[model samples]
Target: MKKMTRYRILMLFSLMIVGITAHSEPYEGVKDIALRRFPWLAKALVFNVIPGIDGNEVFELSSVKGKVMVSASTASAAAEGLNWYLKYYCNRSMSHFGDNLNALAKLPEVGKKVRVVSPYSHRYALNYCTISYSMSFYTWKDWERELDWMALNGVNLMLAPVGMEGVWQNTLRKLGYNDQEIAGFIAGPAFGAWWLMGNLEGWGGPVSQSVIDQQVLLQQKIIKRMKQIGIEPVMHGFYGMIPSSLKNKQSIKVIDQGIWAGGFKRPDFLLPEDPYFDKVADIYYSEMKKLYGEDLHFFGGDPFHEGGSSEGADLAASGKHIQKVMQQNYPGATWVLQGWQQNPANGLLAGLNKDKTLVIELFGENTNNWEKRHGYEGTPFVWSNVSNFGEKNGIYGKLQRFADEVYRAKNSPYGSFLKGVGIIPEGIYNNPVAFDVMLELGWHVDHLDLKKWIGNYTKYRYGKSNVNVDKAWALFLETAYSSPEVNQEGPSESIFCARPAIDIKTVSSWGTRKRNYDVAKFEEAVRIFVTASKDFEGSETYQTDMIDFVRQVQANKADQVYASMIDAIKSKNAGNFKSSSAKFRQMILQQDSLLSTSKYFSVNRWLQQAINFAGTKSDKANALWNAKTQVLFWGPDNNPKTDLHDYAHKEWAGMLSSIYLRRWDAFIDREFAQITSGNVSEPDYFKMENEWVKTGELYTLKPLKKRERDGLVKRILANNQ
Candidate 1:
């Protein structure tokens, strides 16, 4: 154990005091998030508030015949408190929305009062990166369910920037921009994350007025619901990100933020010293208050996000000025900055009042930017882990590393700067084990024995324990999810998500397309997982996860087949190339068929959400195009060989058969034709890719029957043998 300094010990005690004092009374304010998320439990469960529990997020549970008593500080916390009690004490748990619990057939009997207190003041969730890939097109229905999940999992703070476009539009309009100009300022639904980060401007637009207005209403619902459940909503702040044409439209001094990937125009930054800076600030904040209200205490924004030009500007002054406007509008507001590469730069942060700033270490799962920079020069930060990107389907996370890093950061010399820990994945659908452990760490102030914890997690994740399942998880921890190799950002890009390539290097721009784990071990884990399918067939979480693990094993084998084809091509072996290519196609088709068994893995469902949000024929076309463009070929249009093709690709049933498999088949057939003719005709990949992206065609998805899916999964696992 590391010896703590006097300053550190004192700070820890002070934080404990503050945290304990904050929870004086029980909070029974769980609202729509409860009703929408845990509809079964919400109705039957009777909750109460308990003051002075002596610990953070502490809840007392006692149950009668048909009624359950849950006492906590807030109803939102109470919901999680009740959930924790259910999972640990009663042998019942809810892992995800629509996830069934066999125990849900009957309520639990907590014979005596049971209490569990939270260990941390903050338990945060999500990253700005999550907004675009996993949730950009989300309506209130999606938000409602997600919020409920957050409450159940004990998320007290969340980055909830649902309707930022409306705020941007109304602010710009007050600054003399017309309707057409306002439309240009707002990016489409798919690009909200980067747009809010000031990375790009109007690239995926012309957004309709109706959409913007609808978002305003949507945000109101999100914020209100968040407040009811003891969760504090963090809104996006105005930090000098004006439209690309705002300079030409106004006399303000705006900096050209340069261009991003695929030649997209980055948003221009309004200089803090510009005479109209205060005027726009006043209007933007006023407009935000009018729509989203003034109760928000956290604001998130960063200028020059990712790659952008800020060569001449005084960033220190800019940071101070941005915080000035935020603090003025929402007094004592915590300015949330994405703690990413050299961002919230030393000189920049030097100017801001650090007391009101919260920096999220965006990639803490891989990079230790917090310790490397000495905890953002003493400003408060949250240790966060971003284990996924673009919501691309792949099983990956540093589960043990998540526990290790959070524990170390909490005890390091600069630990005082570590306000708390959070889970900030670019997407949240994959790797439920990673999230479970990360959230559990928030309540564990002591070091975690992962060997012991994994057992509890396996028990609760499936609602019952089976030795085969536990062994599979143990193998999983040793293989796919726990490999200790540093690859480029996010999960290793799946070949199933890649556009057809002889030598695939990346699926998304800058994403590393390489496997770093033992393929055989992962397959063995999947095989072990499959044996329990019959035992846990009724469990949704178990079935969904079994499909995912099987899909990963098949995809990895499919990649090997792809490599063999590429190898054959390199050696000019036409016969071998044909054989290997055929196998690659077969592997993808098999994986697709296997994925169709899970309801959550449907391409039709993913696409329909985009379609459902459309208001007009043009709106529908553009909306659908936005959906396809983002996931397939995120682009700037002129360049046929855009490096950003297949950036956010999914390995769902329809996408595999229709898009990726089609592309691979085209590539293979072209090569075979050229080889036979000896014509020296080179295949035009860009043409086929562009043609595919331009077509707003939705493919047919055949969802399999339970027994049919089970049989297919069994057959798929046999290939691994």
Candidate 2:
């Protein structure tokens, strides 16, 4: 009876294995597309192991024909591997998944049960925000968009490292780091923008401990979801940088990053050679393993990301020490470095294990140093673009260069070391098309028809199928998407107050204003934008985007008029000044209205530029002095003993004082001129005008009465309303 039971158990286990394998086949046509687009990548990575027809679908592994099916566990691993391959090679671009999935389903050999995983929630309200301490995770809707992109382009690996703060806190505490220290290390919620930039440090904190704890739980959920979809998670790794509190208990050398000029001490950098380094590394990794599990193969961290010191140590040796500790703790671990701003010292690559290191050529579209240096002497590298800054809304990119460079890299002598491509923007919300085009490039290395691809993209992005929308996109491609020679990181500047808006008389860093922009081309682009806006007139997203686009159009128009005025000023042409100032003021007023219309827009930067332009154009030193003072109070970066409400009162006082100073000067000059002319009416005129000015001044000085103060409060609050 025991022998019979054992035989039955063996048979049951076999059936279960076969059942799991039966359901885990790759989508039909995925392998064919993968092989055709990325022959080298497919050759190295794809592995097929099945040949069967359950219905109309066919099953194959790594392009091979077989029936040695994949179990659920094996399928999950394969998915992760695929994701890594896609991100590393393709740069996490997006594509049309709905059409691709439908096409896959229609294949004669594909089974009805096989379906690509959906990362979206059916209800939009419930999934609009990703629940996490870190806001980097896409909300369910965004995740669905990403998943659709992934499936269409055949991405199986994804890096979902959202909500990792709690994991770090728990780990640090185990290693004897205190709450104060941990708090200092973590960034404030809003400043995640700068934290990602490797700029600014813990400016918005002391973060609540509850937030950290919440992130830990959230990360577990994120990892689980990613796993189910066959995407791999790349967790944060320990580099030598840490919170200043670590210095108190651990004997490690620290470099103060100095105050970032915003009244906060920057995070300190720890030296890798310190004896305490290993202890910290162990605690960090051990904690990561305990919280997220040890299944992850890739880790991301960088030394001296934006700016830091390697003053006392050998740069090469220091890098090796850091990598050595990471590898010792997690075997076969991949060390991911961002090739940003000359940090990680090219010298450091010499000491690190070449095969285990991965370099992200972070600004590939803008910089070619990674390829030029040949991955700093043969370290594996991937091309990437930071296409956006501060994730600001605007449309711009080196479209042709994106295609040209990727092709060049693939055909270069150092091509073998080029692993893949990626998009690493500080803000990922804008530029939907740029992201789509970049990711799709990974799936198609040859015979790329960009126009057809964009036509499909237009339908998918708007979540609709419309002919008019397709026509609008074609116009957009011809205008906004057309490549320009300017070495800009993102879109053209708007005349709005968030960015500097100088008069044409003043040359910007890019040289002459006329040379900076092509007015004729820009006008055409604006027309295209207006036409596109008509199609999505009622869309909230479209309207929000239009607000920025319209301002940019206004700025471009102002630039042309301003340039002509500046030339007239230089030629001593006085007639244009009044008209020029009126145009400038019109631009300012237009921006003010836009900013007032929504809480989203701010005009601080524009105000500062106006002040700068006034100072440069006016000959009188006093005029320049007044403009500078105005900026100090009203500029975006101002700190007048409190927040915006307090600053507004102070600004009103400053403006009154400035007007009084100008009036006082005029009074003295007028009295002198009247005395010189020997006119008796002069004394009477001076007395009358001076008395009126004094009355005006007295009215301004009358201390704010309760009712008056209440009115002011109402007006201030009304700005938001």
Candidate 3:
């Protein structure tokens, strides 16, 4: 019996050694595996999982060994480990893995080092930062970051859909629309945000010919770079949402979207059955071919996003008509639709060719309406997350839900429909951990060890791996990254457009107003964040993200102090008031200084601070008066003329008004006598409150209009007088 046991143990040890050698040795030296079955997956893997593997070497699956299967679990683990390793030794940033989803599908061959090459590469400088507008007009730095991220994560296919405006312009002109009318259909540079949001019309148009020309040139460059790195580009496709200029020139019944607030008219929806539809489609395709060439197979466009009306027509027929035009223009083209907010109407889907359609299940974890409604619906789909909105600063997501959803999708009856996973954040600069984790899902398909993954990520992000940082990350996973019950937008409220100097009376949808956060946990996170910040502070990526994290912690701490003052005031203890008032004043001043010191303070934070001070009701009417003045004077609406700025200002103004209303009502009930006796009189108090109320009402009724410069100047002088 002893001899038999010894023999068995020797056999087991030999097998273990063989397994380790088979799995690790194959991937040695070769570095990048450019898998052709899923070329995109290879790109994503290399770019995200192995930051330093950037060369031209296609890795075949036959060379992979051991348990090198693609699934959420495996991908997540690999990404986590890769992130830690890169940060620990390479001193390089990882890209959001793209295309690597394919690599996760099958096990690779044993005893070969796989170096996957994808079209995507990383830009060291483009660490996540607030975009002035949208990514439609990417700068060279933007392209570099995108490419770097691609190479880091191993993405071989990229969606370069810019320069379509020029394509559409030429298409419209050929179909008899005048330059002015065609230009009216195009949006301005700043309006890209709204256009991407699927919310507004081409407000700032007619687009400058110069801008159109620039975008055309830009797309050419983007495509060239992507091709060099082995990434296939997905260009823009036509889905019948044409400029209204086509209405008179073509025999088509136009579906007008009315005014897109701000007095801008939406593009007219061209009927698919219209004779001109065929002509326009041909023109559009010809121009696309002329500029981008006929090498592309994938195209993206959505008809009637948000709340588009499809009245007076058969929705199913309309969808079929649109697809027919696309097929006729570019045979075998893949159509991409954003499964966002009841879009790609059910009737529309009924008419699409299942094999040709690629549905993006945007906001999958947040809202599973798509999966629940059409899990077995046969069309190939990819899971995605819109974690951030308007790139607002805040932390909120369904982390576990991400893993859960991928698991459910993989095992569902429509499992075959689940093609892969992706990250579609409105802003990619904030919540690096969330972004990292989400991308990792593409490589994993089962239960993932999140702790190990986080450790790996910390090592890569910090450039030098440390156990202390690893422990800190573990704490972060438990605290900051821990799932919250509420639906918050991002990690912290953006102070860029916050109501200036307002006390947070109510939490925004993004969870910024909550004062009951665990300070001890946050403090732990701060220590880790500060440590990581120190190491990467010199790197541009670190400067953009880590410095911001430090400032956010400080601001959040100050917010807690402000929240305490409000609690004290509500306590109604004169003794507490006597002590708390001075402290509150000091804290408010300190917060103001801290806010000013930060170069990138969000408007939301500024507004919250002002509101908090006003809401305290300390120092009789002076506090309220100052709060009210600051809110009304420095409101986001006081910015330059631009649709993006206008939208921000309107939001800030509404928040300020809401805070003022709450305070005004409180004062009327608590200090009516002071007002009647003229002891607390401000010349414009009544007018300001009334005007604020009116503005808020307007925002509710319709989007806020840009305040005219002369009118604003007059109001300012009147308030002073």
lDDT of 1 by residue, 103-168 (tens): 467766787777766656678888877888778778888888788778778888899888888888
Q: What global local distance difference test value does model 3 have?
A: 0.51
Q: What is the alpha-carbon RMSD of candidate 2 to the true structure? A: 14.3
TM-score of each: 0.92, 0.64, 0.66
TM-score, candidate 2, is 0.64
lDDT of 2 by residue, 540-646 (tens): 44444445445445555655555554555455455564456455545544433443332223322222322332212331222223223222222122332211111
| lDDT value for model 2 | 0.49
Q: Tens-digit lDDT track for model 3 on 1-721? A: 9999999999999999989766663321112323422243343343222233333222222122233322111222233333332333334454321111212233323344333322112111110111222243355555655654554343434456667778878887787778777666665543444453344545444455656787688788877666554456667677777766556765678788665533445677777777777777788889999998877777777777767767865777887877777787788887877787787778888888888887777776567655676752677777667666555444445566677777777787767687766776655545666666766565454655776766766555554576656766566556656665555544545332332223643333233555234646755665655455445534444343443444445445545544554555455444554454444334333323332322233334333332332222332133222223322332222332222221222123234235433433343333233323435532333344335533313222122122332232222222121
Which regions in candidate 2 have their CA more than 4 angstroms from the true location?
1-12, 20-161, 174-177, 193-199, 255-265, 462-479, 498-517, 525-551, 561-721
Candidate 1: where are CA atoms >4 Å away?
1-28, 31-40, 52-56, 62-67, 95-98, 102-106, 110-114, 483-485, 719-721
Q: Which scores greater on TM-score, model 1 or model 3?
A: 1
Leading candidate by lDDT = 1
